[model samples]
Target chain A: MITAMSDASAPPVPGFVESTFSPLVHAAVHRCLGVAPPGDGARTAIVLASTVGDATTLDTGSRSLVAGQAHQPLLFMQSTANAILGRLAVDLAVTGPLLSLSTAVPDDVAGELLTTGALLLETGEADRVVLVGVELAAGDRAAAAHRALGTVPPAEDLAVALLLDRDDPVPHLPELPAHPPPAAPPDGYGTLRGLVALAARNQGTPP
Target chain B: MRREVLLTGYGVRTAFGTGAEALRDGVFDGRPAFAPVTRFDTGPYRTDAAATHGPAVPLREVLAETAAAAVRMAGLPAGARADVLVGTAGDFTALTRFWRTRGRDADAGGAAGSDGAGGAGVVETVPAWQAAALADALGVRGTRLAFTSACVASAMAVVHGCLLISSGRADTVLCAGAYLVEEENLAKFGSGFALSRDGAVRPFCADRSGLLLGDGAAAVVLESADGARRRGARPLAALTGWGVAGDAHHVARPHPEGAGLAAAAGRALRGAGLPRVGYVNAHGTATRHNDPAETRGLRAVFGPYADSVPVSSTKSTTGHLLEAAGVVELVITLLALRDGVLPPTAGFTEPDPLCDLDFVPNRPHKADLRAAMTVNAAFGGVNTALVLERT
Candidate 1:
């Protein structure tokens, strides 16, 4: 069984969120596994999942620069939902296939994240794989409500990263619910919120 | 673990006429279908030549006409249900126009009553929604996907269709690509100096400066070999292999060294299980940058055989169809493989010394082609290659 979850946000320590989140999440997961963080050169795999990949930074930059130019908004390149994977790869120093997927459907997104994370561990693509789901809030009220309800959010920014391993302690929840998990949080805040919930759940002894 | 997927049927709409007969006649008789721009006012743009239609036809109508024709040719049941995959650069040219007009109206302080009813009013009018329209028209109840990968959209649609069949997700898939001329896109290309000046397209020619824009739709019915056999369907050609690669180098220009193009070609060849190829239907946009880059990439991959393999650019006749170019050229490639005839690269006169290859020029050539490859390189450094084998 694969088990690990953590959250990171952009509000506090925006610059170091990605770099710090991986090691922090790694430490939390290692604590649960009763192992130390692997040193450099140790084989580890990472699969980044995000709806607002590199496109976020590109969008911010484009919005900043569009005021001066009379050209088409380079919005096309600014919205790829895969930049987070590249950041995670750099942070974790992972040398493995980085798969990025975007699903508008919430339930499907959660299942896909778990399934992909499981595959990476099973296939030996990575010894310990990290699955990250990141999204930016759309500044819409309906989106925020959806994020809070674990359903399709109207639009919110959140990021949640989960570490999955083959030899990890399984969570002792009431039951593995048959119903699908709600869509992952929006890009920024939702990600951090979900990660917090994951970290809290993994804080105590493994059952 | 790739499975064999076949192109059991195809449909096409072009300026020459609709259906396979018209396309075949246009290809064989050396007919050019380019005419004055009718879809929009060309005064703001400098170009005079385009594959214009008599009147602006709704995309739904255009898709239905060609799709039904292809279904009839395939002899599938009228009520047949299959997966639907649509490829296009722009989903709704008319919708975009509508939005632009709405914007103008809002700016002029027109009453908001023209916005129509309900919050879902304008949202339902998007071109992306047309995929569902086509799916509904074909009575396809299985998976439906819309791909918009610039010029490589339709080719990717074909690739995805094959994947769907091989993965057993669907027994039959309708892979279609469409593009109707939009003023903004045309003006953008014209400003970029990519549009041809002579009101004609001349690919791989020494004097070739750029490409001429055209609008049309092409679709293919893909099915698993076992499924086709079970249905007693005769396949026109087999979709042997396909490869998609991103340049990650530039947004508009291809990799200066043709790295991504070569990689995509290698992947397609590997997928097809063929080390050498018989013919190549090149992207050959006729632009100074595209032609030479493609020629160099071909040489890098095919080596000595590159000089001998009869390569042609159908864009010379059809003009650059943007997203629809891949499917249109693909249909032509399938026709070539089936008929054992290599279509000519229409506009070649004096060959460029840099592009040293045997580009079957002026007229079609008869040959015993076992396999043919089609290449498409998009503006965003997205490159795709497809291999088709004679059935």
Candidate 2:
């Protein structure tokens, strides 16, 4: 049985400008783990849940010349649902086994992510696991949707990193949404985007 | 509890050429299938290395053809029953190309429908779809799943398939791994300085620089001892044990101390009920970091036996097949066991001092082997080990 979840964030550390969303999530994980910036010794399994990963990296030339260019679909290579684990590993020099999953429904994605993190803890795979959820709403489709809604953009980038420990205490928070919700179309990135939103909302941060 | 997982049949389509028989013959004759990349213009890519058979054949057709060949090699009846397990790093490269095309044309909807015709909705072609396509071609009716853990994908798929058989979920499981070199992979790895500069792969050698990327597919038919006996199939090898671990270290780079890899190998040996192994088919990518790290890990696990037991990396011939590396290497290990010979590590001239293990060099060595181990570490810090015993 796994039950503890704590979220943390960083104020955009310098010299880590590969991607805005990833570094923010990494900083949050580092803060939650209470280790140095990279935190390789956290002994944690990382599950990267995202809706749109690295969409900002797609070039305009590629987008105009190629159809899925805006999607930066090739960026999928760097964007596993659990890609943060890879990034953290590279940063922290970790070599632990990492697992990633993606689900279309927001509620189902959160539930499954939490359940899987708990399972990993229960199975003795890791004593603590880091769950990083990030979403970047800069893609063409997302921009078009924002324009159609005629609403001011809240935030374009959101990230949340939760440090889950089997023996840690749980924090009191607002009620979480219900599970077994309606299924959404399979986006390239999954519930990771929603996780970022949940994290920002929990922090009382807009976007 | 330990269960005996037998290799009832095996199939391979590789750069050394197609069909299991051809691969076996090439292995026996020291033939390598590596060649210059011709599938696409790799002008911007750093490494020009690949294991392609031809420029005209697409990866999907290659997958279907190899899967059919594997089924034929297994000699399963027309209506045989078996679960399907596929291990892959990514979905079809063709789908990526399709996405690039469809992303350009807003009028073109997403993935093509099941009918192979274009559809209006988003085209979702995942790794499972490829597995389903292979299943449909084989007329197999069983649970199908795709394991995608980068390099260890197919190894885990084989292990999971074995678990299904042991747990009585299916009598036989078809485990296959397929991956093709794409521009994205070439560019990303090249940009990271991951590929070799000389376009040559020299595993465990002092002059070894880095890995050379290649693409290919391999499959094996796994079954319980009872199932194989019932089918009267000649067993190729017995998959005795498997161990999986995550380094929790770095994604691309391995733990400097190789602690996670050591644990995985130890667990695999323990699962196999063996105190030591005869040979180790190493995951020697020949990179500046991997060869030494893997060597240290092997020494840590096998200790005194590390120097005596023959260890070699066949990737010198096939190049690093990435996700498909495990299955291809497993097939080679099985062949080694059957032939009573160890394949040599090609291009290994000067020995790396850090890597002191007995890497059967330039020429193959004939030896009687009872059990062998294959180790693979992937990009996500996922490490896996599979132990096979002579039947």
Candidate 3:
């Protein structure tokens, strides 16, 4: 069962730069984490999903290296999605398993995220899972990947965070992709549309 | 009860060569695969070498071969569809090609992202795309999960594959991963000053400098006991217990106490119902920060028993496989259990007082063993411990 959730537009995340990936994640997670019970962090697992991870940082960092300019090793560090997940784990004091997934499965982004969350509980790894699905607005290089993804690219960075508990498992959570969007502008948001609608439903807010 | 998972076959390719036998022979002999980087000119870099495949083969092709080998060895049917979980940083060879083709222009301060054709070619550089292509190459239509958790990616792949089977989500799971040294990671490791100046990874040594990279590609086929029996497949080993945890500490550096690693190992031992592991294939990157932390984690898990069991890092032989290191080491651990010979740490100069465990060093040591553990820690403070015992 989803206990809490939030969706975020592009927002400045403090201490992170260059790409909106972490910030978008931080914005959504920061809001949802507040709904978590105090001291519940130790049992909370963090799962991050993205099709193409921080290509902006990777592209810029490699370019800097080829040109022999001073490159921020920070770019290399942040390019991997786990870096921010690690930081968030530290910040939130969550000691459960930290994991990330990269896939462009055309359908069922939310279902995939939730299924992984269920697996964490099924494996006795965690009692609660924080699932975040993030996708960046397509750039020229990312556009082709997005086209293959069969989803209309959002014009801006998109992220949604959901907090799932093991008990009261949703039998048809896997069928969420076919459901209509919850009354928002993302009646058509491709990659993260299902996640956004789910979040809205859980939050008791009209999407 | 959860279903039992068995390892029927495995495939590995390193500088030592292809098959698990080749890996065992080379690593047990304390051979080093490190050579000068042959893929490109490393003149401008700090350390211009890693344990590469030498002749230059794409990492994807290597994965394909390893995957097919594991499947063939496991005696799976030609049309058998198995879930593929891989830990990779995508097709860096394509990235290398893109860099090589665009280097002249980009290095001259030309805008890098404007090349549409060049960028499209590298879409396979993403693990998802690479993984999808791998599944297609294997001619199976099944689920594929791509893990990108840095060093421990493939280890997590193995652990989760076990979970998928035990929970009745899958019957046969193909867990595979490979990471060949590339300029992007090399530049990153160099910038971080993590590479050993001497090019030798003397794990747990008092004067240990650091780790080097290598070409590590490996795959293993895991099947439920019932599934294997129905297929009349012989089991090579049993994947008894596994655990994964996060440090909740630093992102790039391990916790000084190896807090997460201890938790993972302890969880694994508990699940395996083995109070003591016969051998431990340590993550042992030979970095100043990693060894001591691993020592603490071992102590935390084993207590006095830590001194009894043998511990060693084959990274001293294979160099570091990065993301691929864990799965390759898992295969190494299996071979050790299969033969009951613990592979040496290879380049141990002297033991650091902080690392007081009995690291089977410099030479292979024979021991009658029941089970062994392979532990891998990644950049995100994520740690995974897998226990494999004889069936």
User: Candidate 3 on B94-194: residue-level lDDT in tens?
Assistant: 66566555775566677665344465466677787767777888886678878888898899789889989988988999999998777777887887788
lDDT of each: 0.61, 0.63, 0.81
| Model 2 TM-score, all chains together | 0.74
Residue ranges of candidate 2 with Cα displaced over 4 Å: A1-83, A86-96, A101-207, B75-81, B99-125, B167-170
TM-score of chain B of each: 0.93, 0.91, 0.96
Candidate 2 lDDT tens digits, B1-391: 3347889777787776776566666554555556678877766666677666655355446666766777777788876788777775434344345435445454565443222221111112244445556777788887555555667778877766766666555688898887777665665566567788886778888888788776678888888888888878888889887776666665456766666678788878987889788889999988888888889888898987878988888877777787688888898888888888888887778988988889988678888999999999876567778899998
Candidate 2 interface RMSD after superposing interface residues: 7.4
What tier of docking accuracy does candidate 1 attain? incorrect
The sequence of per-residue lDDT tens digits that candidate 2 reaches over residues A72-191 is 323433433334556666565544446543222333334445654665565454676776555554444333222322211114455556766667532323344342221232322233
Instruction: List, for all models, the DockQ compared with the true complex.
Output: 0.08, 0.16, 0.57
Best by DockQ: 3
**Superposition error at B340 for model 1 (Å):** 2.1
Give the poorly placed runs of model 3, Cα more than 4 Å off. A1-15, A148-152, A171-188, A204-206, B99-116
Higher-ranked by TM-score: 2 or 3: 3
- Could you tell which candidate, 1 or 3, scores higher by lDDT? 3
Question: Model 2, DockQ value?
Answer: 0.16
In candidate 3, position B80 carries an lDDT of 83
Better of 2 and 3 by DockQ: 3
